[model samples]
Target chain A: AQSVSQHNHHVILSEAASLELGCNYSYGGTVNLFWYVQYPGQHLQLLLKYFSGDPLVKGIKGFEAEFIKSKFSFNLRKPSVQWSDTAEYFCAVEAAGNKLTFGGGTRVLVKP
Target chain B: DTAVSQTPKYLVTQMGNDKSIKCEQNLGHDTMYWYKQDSKKFLKIMFSYNNKELIINETVPNRFSPKSPDKAHLNLHINSLELGDSAVYFCASSRVTDRFGTEAFFGQGTRLTVV
Candidate 1:
C-alpha cells in the first residue's frame, strides 16, 4: 500500500503572497499525482495533476505543481494567492493498479 | 448537473445504529470510491469499485461495507457504528481509461455524527 505525507498541516499567509505546500508519496513504480482543494462546506475539486510528460503541470486558478520523481515529491505552488484561496488542500497519489492515497491535508488560511 | 452527488449530506445517529450513504455519478465513469475525512482533515480511502466489481478494500474494518448496484452508483453501509466513526464521508468517481485526467470527481460529502 502506498502512503502520502504533507509537511505542513496548516499554513497562513496574506493575500498576494506566494505559497507552496510540500507533498511526498511512497511508491516505487509509476505514479500519478494530484492536488485537490476543498473549500468551506464544499466538495474536493482537482487543482492540478501530474501523470507523465513534463514535470511541471499547470492547473486551474493559477495553481501549479512540479513532479520530482527522484525526490518522490509533487509540490503545489502559486505565485500569488488571494483570500479566496483559503481552503484545505490535499495531495494524492495513484499508483498503477492501486487505489488513490491521500496525504493529511494542509489548511491554508489566506488573510486579505 | 452535479458530476458526483451523495445523499443525506448530514447524518446524526446513535453509536449502535446502522446507516447508509448513497452516491451516484452522472459522469459515466467506471470507477467509484469511498473516502473518510477525519476531524483533523485526514482523508483515507475505504473502498473502491470498478465497473461494479470490488477492487480496493484499503484495510477498512468489516463493519463498513460498500455496495455497487451498478457502475454509476455506490453506497456505503455502516453497522454498529462507533464514536470514532464520526467524520465526513466523501464519494468520488473516475474513469478507468484515465480520460478524466485520472482525477477523481468528488461529492459534497456526508458529515456523519455518532452521538
Candidate 2:
C-alpha cells in the first residue's frame, strides 16, 4: 500500500513570508502528485498538480511544487503568503487510475 | 456551478443508526470516490467506483458500503454507525482514463457527527 507523509503538521508564517511544506511518499511506480487547499468553511480546492512534464509545476495563488522522483518527494512552495492563505493543505498521490492516497494535512496559519 | 456536490452537509446521528451520504457530479466523469477525513484531518480513501462498478476498496470496514446508481453519482451508506465513524466525508469525481493533468474535484464534504 502506498503512503504519504507530511513532515509539517502545523505551520505558522507572517504575511509576505516564503513558505515550503515538505511532502514525501512511498511508491515506486509512476505516481501523480497534487496539492489541495481547504479554507475555513470552504471545500477543498486544487492548488497544483504534477502528472507528466516539467518537475516544477505552478498552481493557483502563486503556489508551486517540485516533483522529485528520486527522493520520492513533492514539496509545496510559495514565494510569499497572505493572511487569506491560512488554510489546511493536503498532499495526495495517485499510483492507480483515480484512487488517491492523501497525507496528513498541514494547517498553515498566515498572520498579518 | 459546482462540479461535485454532496447532500446533508452536516449530519448528526446516534450510534447504531443508519445513515447515507449522497453525492453527485456534473462533470460527466466516469469515476467517483468517498474519502473520510478524521478529526486530525487525515484523509483516507474509503471506496472508489468507476462506471458504477466497484474498483478500489481500501481498509475500510464492511459497515461502510458505497452504492453507485450511475456514472455520475456515488452514495455511501453506513450501517450500524459508531462513534468512530464520526468524521467529515468528502465526495470526489474524476475522469477514469489515466489522463495526464486531470485531478479529482472534491465536494463540500459532509461532516458526520455520531453521538
Docking quality category of candidate 1 according to DockQ thresholds: incorrect
TM-score of 2: 0.54
Candidate 1 has what TM-score? 0.54
Here the TM-score of candidate 2's chain B is 0.93
Q: What TM-score do all the candidates reach, one by one?
A: 0.54, 0.54
Q: Write the per-residue lDDT of candidate 2 for residues A50-76, one digit (tens) a residue.
A: 889999999999999999999999999
What would the C-alpha RMSD of candidate 2 be, to one decimal place? Answer: 14.8
DockQ of each: 0.04, 0.04
Question: Which digits, one per residue and each the tens of the lDDT, describe model 1 over residues A1-112?
Answer: 7989999987889999999999999999999888988665344667887879999999999999999999999999999999888887889887875546677678788887
Give the runs in model 1 whose Cα sits over 4 Å from its true position.
Answer: B1-115
Per-residue lDDT, model 2, residue A48, is 88
DockQ of 1: 0.04
- In candidate 2, what are the lDDT values of residues B1-115, reduced to their tens digit? 8788899888999999999999999999887888887543446678888889998898988999999989999999999999999888889876522212133567767888899
Instruction: Give the whole-model CA lDDT for all candidates, comma-separated.
Output: 0.83, 0.83
Backbone clash count for every predicted candidate, in the order shown? 0, 0
